[model samples]
Target: MEPAEMTSLRAALAESDFAKPPRINLRGEPIPDGLTTAVVYQGHEVVTDGSKPLRGLDRVIGGS
Candidate 1:
């Protein structure tokens, strides 16, 4: 991606409610401080606890 696109993407994510990803992993375990996880579902990155869709992820990722 271009720098401008990356900047826009970062700005969008920063302004999103799911910017702070879930604390637990897919296994439902407590994530340690300073650590994070990336979960992909149906070819899209989602902020879930193995159940719910991200609060604002659909807008960010343009998923239906």
Candidate 2:
């Protein structure tokens, strides 16, 4: 994705309340707070954590 698109997406996520931190785990159970292994991005190279449940928005806009 283009840098401009990434910036726009990041801004939109910041404005939306539904946008929460991402989670990274192999288990089916949810991960606890402050234990994120890394800041994963939904589409491109944005910073996201695993603080909230996964949603459609968490998925990449286009093919990754």
**Best model per TM-score:** 1
Which digits, one per residue and each the tens of the lDDT, describe model 1 over residues 20-51? 56534354675455334354533445444334
Model 1 off-target regions past 4 Å? 19-55
User: What are the TM-scores, per candidate, against the unseen true structure?
Assistant: 0.39, 0.30
Model 2 alpha-carbon miss at residue 6, Å:
0.1
Among the numbered candidates, top lDDT falls to 1
Q: How far is each candidate from the true structure, as Cα RMSD in Å?
A: 9.6, 8.3
Scanning candidate 2 in windows of ten residues, the lowest lDDT window is: 17-26
Which lDDT values do the candidates have, in the order given?
0.51, 0.44
Error of 2 at 29 (Å): 24
User: Weakest 10 consecutive residues, lDDT, candidate 1?
Assistant: 34-43
